[model samples]
Target chain A: MEENTTTEKIFPPGSVGLVKSQDFHFAPGEVLELDCGRTLRDVTIRFETYGTLNADKSNVILVEHALTGDAHLAGYHTAADKKPGWWEEMVGPGKPFDTNKFFIICSNILGGCSGTTGPGSPDPDTGKPYHMDFPVITISDMVRAQKHLIDHLGIKKLLAVAGGSMGGMLAIQWPISYPDVVESCLAIATSSKISPQSIAFNWIGREAIMSDPTWNNGDYTEQPQKGLSIARMLAHVTYLSDQSMSRKFGRKLQTAEDYSFKFDMDFSVESYLNHQGTRFVERFDANSYLYITRAIDYFDVSDSADGDEHKVFEKVKCPFLVVSFSSDWLFPPYQAKELTRLLLENGNDVTYCDIKSHYGHDAFLLEYETLGKLVDNFLDNIYKEKEGK
Target chain B: MKIAHNPSDSEPILSRSDLVMIADMIPENAKVLDLGCGSGRLLRVLKARKNARIMGVELDQEKLIQCMERGVPVIQADLNEPLSLFADASYDYVILSRTLQAVKRPDLILQEMLRIGGKGIISIMNFGQLDARMQMLKGHMPVTKRLPLKWYDTPNIHPGMLSDFRDMCREKGIKILKELPVSQHRDFLRFLAPVCPNLFASNAIFVISK
Candidate 1:
């Protein structure tokens, strides 16, 4: 087992330690009926599990990852790895998710380009990448695929379905789609429906991707690096706030004392976004990005109820812990509050908080201490209540 | 459906005397919403003793965490802002204990409270109490055990006399369901509170309805 080191701790305390991702291939005859009226076969889900699933399988917490996040939620795949996981701060033996107490499972989302089967994966029938032929998947479709994975584990009900951002949308969808399968939900920095502003940003991102000649309409052998990078750069701006950007970069020039005056990434913020864009294209697929953002834009938890957001949650019985950040303009606190309001009006248990942070939508991943405590207490209480029953 | 006639010996230590009185006033299994619920002490008490389904609305970050720790459902929201998130008549009782005076507008808060809940329980610290009067006479601001913070540093921007609350209720057509005057932190002259609440009581709990 190799150790991942980001800081002084070569082997960090409270770490879940070295873990490996496992792929679950669906058996024949289990066709996934997608929301877009397409049938998907030979589905494969890449997942990682931490801790132990207790007797009766009641201690499981299904962690859904945000856009660009994969099955590597915590721990390290190799000792030479520089980073452990996306949410290593909140998932460890004694951390917020508390592997000592509850079994944690995180899977790469369906429309993802990680180890999971996605647009980048070879189509079973064609023996070639699905590319643009990949049927549009929704957040509910992702949850449905996860449900199959959960059933394959022989778990009847999850202790909680937890996630942030697009992951939060999955968390919100789980209980509504399969109320009996979820005990509770933790939705952080997400809205039940994508706002128009967010949809517009996604539009620009897709435009940037499709406009690239290398994209070849998602059929190129080589990845559309420039278009994907630009898309990632544009998407990254939405994840951060103006206050955060100002505080982090201000008007400081990157590696330059004097202004270039031309279009030469003079500002530190520009350089940072450029770096983010460059790094993203190396890991993510252009087609997967298109599919995932479209899935997010198409997500509306209230779609089944004639656009009545309140009525959509009529079948949901589980409690919710909805959290948003003070500076997150993308999925603002008011949107989370509106979701909470609808849940409350429908007579459901909902706990909410607009955490005071400058981290914007990314606060869900950064504000570990505050966010961790909230998650810890919520999961602890839910576990206790489950045990008592 | 079973109501506790008296508080159990196992009540949480965070519960104050005034909070206990407010908890006692709530019925069994009542859906209660506590506005400015500091650390959720009263909500916990109601949940334990009365089997109430309780939620809290608190603005303070630390208190919001405390509420989560205590397993009480809470929303981090400001009292001065429009509480339009909660629908009308969604709760059995809405509580603003010991926090009415600190709000920007007590009248609007009371109306909101009543709108969301069937009954609103407001505990207001009396600005016209004898101790406050004595302090005013001596030309110093009141700093009693109940109202310990200095005038300059206090959050009590809209502090008012007990009669002021009654007059506002009357003007707004809000009925005073019950009023319980109570002394806080070992005050000696507590017995005279109910007799002459405006002049004697350190603080009073008013159960009002529209």
Candidate 2:
């Protein structure tokens, strides 16, 4: 939509890398009104679309971003932004989400710190960062915002909609909210609702952010940073696997051999966590973190009905392909299966696979090579059949 | 406590309402085979409703997808053509719901149904209603709620009356374990047709066994 040239190397040959952002402008310094009644003026969403949209705009695949992910799904953008695309393993020329045949669209979520409008934006109502005053948002509300973006792109029907984790939740809702729009869906490492333990971890992250003295009730515009760093460290633990952590570090020391048992970073785990947290603050805003995580925390679900028996199970009219990770304790397998069962009972076309991986809840994002093959096959079938339709 | 094993436990293909009714008739934890199960809804319900093990057979690819989605154990195949897959009397209850009229030869299917389950439930719409007669006289086959479609598009290959089916059952030595008919949807056709339902009843939902 715009004449823009950008490039950045994200990963080594085999693994997946950073997510990118590119889009048409609604004019520079434009203001975006959020569904929460909070307006984010002068806002931009980082986005990338692979393959071709075709003549009918039917081969579009909307990829939802994970917690800390941006829209940059592959390649580079600028020198300031270094790192491979987040889904480097799963998406590329010939991966599962094959960018070769389908038009893949990914965006930095609304409340994300990277390029999207979030709490970091100037609050039109108050000129300063909305901080705690940023109204709470639901997953439905998040979908609502994305709907605007989709409409702007002028896509009519989607061939396949897919995502993992928070992204997966969006993929599942896509068909239900916009029934006739999606042909088949790919929902991985997600659930109908977040588990209790996930909520607890989210709260812990929030508390750690609030407890920091630098987080002056979220008023430190220049740097309400330390608190967000701590929150990221805690969240990072949940993202990685026990086996991965053990294999990568073990009980080995980060520095000295002897037990200095002080508050210093003795274990490699501590050093790794600190590094992840410290890097997070540089690209992210504390207020935005507060807003987005809370949005994810507020997810609660039941039957997708609107009081009509004949119309109740009618919402999810599209074919479903749901995948949940076996080792994802946060959302877990039961919740995923529960989603599968409900959709099945409602008479929707569905396929669910619970992938076995010890990479923990964030495995869907990291375990790209495995996820890549599944995506590739799933899309190739759809693409071939989609030709006639 | 005698629960049978089914392949479709991982993929249930029935609706909530269909499952509820199927559950009501089946004994708790009994062996079940749901034929023409659109996504194994009834079988899945029986599984959860009574912890009964169920095997479902369906033809449609979409419904099969739904069955797998629900984790109800199911096999994607036709219900007719001798069910040599399982042994004789491998099931306790064989269910054919709203699928009788759709089959080319329901009589053969019913015979298989009885052979598979010691007891079986057969739910079919009564085509010998006064409404069909009225439409026949008025020169339009019939289009009531029970017979929703106009003749051409109807899925029912051979529509027959309740008495007609019962007559066929009698010929096959299939005794009526229970026979229930409906007019106002689930509310039994009572007061009007009780002692003799041949003329008054408009729809029939029955349970029979060999």
Candidate 3:
């Protein structure tokens, strides 16, 4: 049976199988303008695609990645790779994204570190890394850069723009920023604006990184591992719920049945967070973290509407699907409901759901059964409607 | 599951007669919002027949997926809770079919329906029919074709008669634009239902405006 299983398949059922990433570099003369009133040149975007684009080019879908996520959304990069894409379950041949029927594209955001133009990328003018010199960005800025990529690909209108968490913010921005180009949107487990509580958490995470002596004011020879790990540890707590933490750890000791009587990371939850922090520091740059979180903090779709959140989407014409988790304190269900209300007030067709889950904000990554079905059916319906059948 | 048979061959096959009657009340190209829309059968018929812009709110996740499968826009929400997400007078018609008894506050839901929509259509099971009255006379709870479940196990917590609905509407200052007694079975009750709706009809559909 072991030999049969190993020889029978190169990839699992519903898998996108082996995939490769591609890069898109902006033309020299293009010189993209930023929301912060600065101009950037030689911008690069790392992206990946699945399925075929079709004859009419109407089967394209742009999937946005959340914080700390990259262009690799589904399938194995290599045959021996232990982990598939972050959204492996939702983006395969028969999964919610249904790669067989629609061409799926996911790109690293402009301020993202994974093969995208960010703080670590070299500055053409200075002949060194941009570092702190990288223009301050916003969610809209990331989406603006994405629009250029979509236009370059010659897709006149996208079937849908979808994502969760910070990705959700980008999804929301796409429809508003380019209403005529996007046919629909799926914003899951996200808010239109960052709440004060969220801002405070981001502040603490940034503070942890800046406090490290090795950080060297964002110009350190070596990456600030300790500070970045501490930041990741604190940020990880916000991604989980009290119920989830209690169920997973429940004050369980790491190696002993009794208390250690000293602060040596004895609790299981502490050890788990430490491991997450250390793992994150290895792949992510601290400077990129500062820029991306700041972009998230500055995101407010209602800025053009005199701070009236209800009128943010008045000019947007596409239908929307908004999903939130019951235990997601970071982007609570009420916040999502508020966005739905705003859409309804403008007479926009919007479907909203608060999925019952204990996985908190991370429910967007987990809870595939319920969330996946919602996306699958939602996107299918939109496609059918667009076809006029 | 027992499928309700409709006598009209041109109408949708899966929908009950009461749902057909409710769909008939809506005009062509009207925007509709259906509360407690189970599997979106009525909305599908409306979309196909009237070319109506359709949306639904269903509590059951499975039914919500079924609605999406039928290309009907739907929101997952409890009818018992406040439906404040929908703006006032946003829809041309709001429908609550065969779900009045199951909700915690049918009166409040009616008001909310009319508040969000220009007109509200409701189809309720008539508990005062002759079969139920006969069961009561025999000192047993009702077990009619329409009200099939036992009293203790039923989700219908506030079942009422057609007269009760009229009186509630009068007291609540809700104008009943039209009312129709519906009987799906091909029996004498179908003839008598229209004459004495409170005692013979299996169900009643009401079109009301605020």
Off by over 4 Å in 3: A1-9, B1-12, B186-188
Quote the lDDT for B19 in model 1: 76
Q: What TM-score does structure 1 among the candidates reach?
A: 0.96
Backbone N/Cα/C clashes per model: 2, 42, 0
Q: Which stretches of candidate 2 lie over 4 Å from their true place?
A: A1-20, A23-43, A78-82, A125-127, A303-313, B1-210
Over the true interface residues, superposed, what is the Cα RMSD of model 1?
0.8
lDDT of 2 by residue, A206-265 (tens): 888888888888777665567788899988888777887888899999889777968899
Alpha-carbon lDDT of model 3: 0.89
Worst 10 residues of 3 chain A by lDDT: A1-10
Give one digit per residue, the lDDT tens place, for model 3 in A214-327: 988899767899999999999899999999999999989899878879889889999999999999988999999999999988878898577887778878988899999999
**Candidate 3 per-residue lDDT over residues B1-210, each given as its tens digit:** 122455665655554778767777789999999999989888988887788988899988788878887777788888999899898899999999889999999899999999999999999989998888999999998987667899999999998999999999999999999999988674336789989999988889999999
- Score residue A16 of candidate 3 by CA lDDT: 91
Residue range with the least summed lDDT across 10 consecutive positions in model 3 chain B: B1-10
Question: How high is the lDDT of residue A283 in model 1?
Answer: 94
Candidate 2: residue B60 Cα off by (Å)? 24
lDDT of each: 0.89, 0.70, 0.89
| lDDT by residue (tens digit), candidate 1, B103-206 | 88888999999899999998888899888889899999898876889999998898799899999999999999998887755665877877898888888899
lDDT tens readout by residue for model 1, A1-389: 55435543466788887899999999998989998899899999999999999888989999999989999999987667678899999999989999999899999999798888899899999999899999999999999999899989999988899999999999999999998889999999999999999999999999999999999989988889999999999889888988889999999999988998898999999999999999998899999999999999998888968888768988888889999999998899989998998898988878898888998888888999889989998998898888788
Give the Cα error of residue A49 in candidate 2, in Å.
2.1
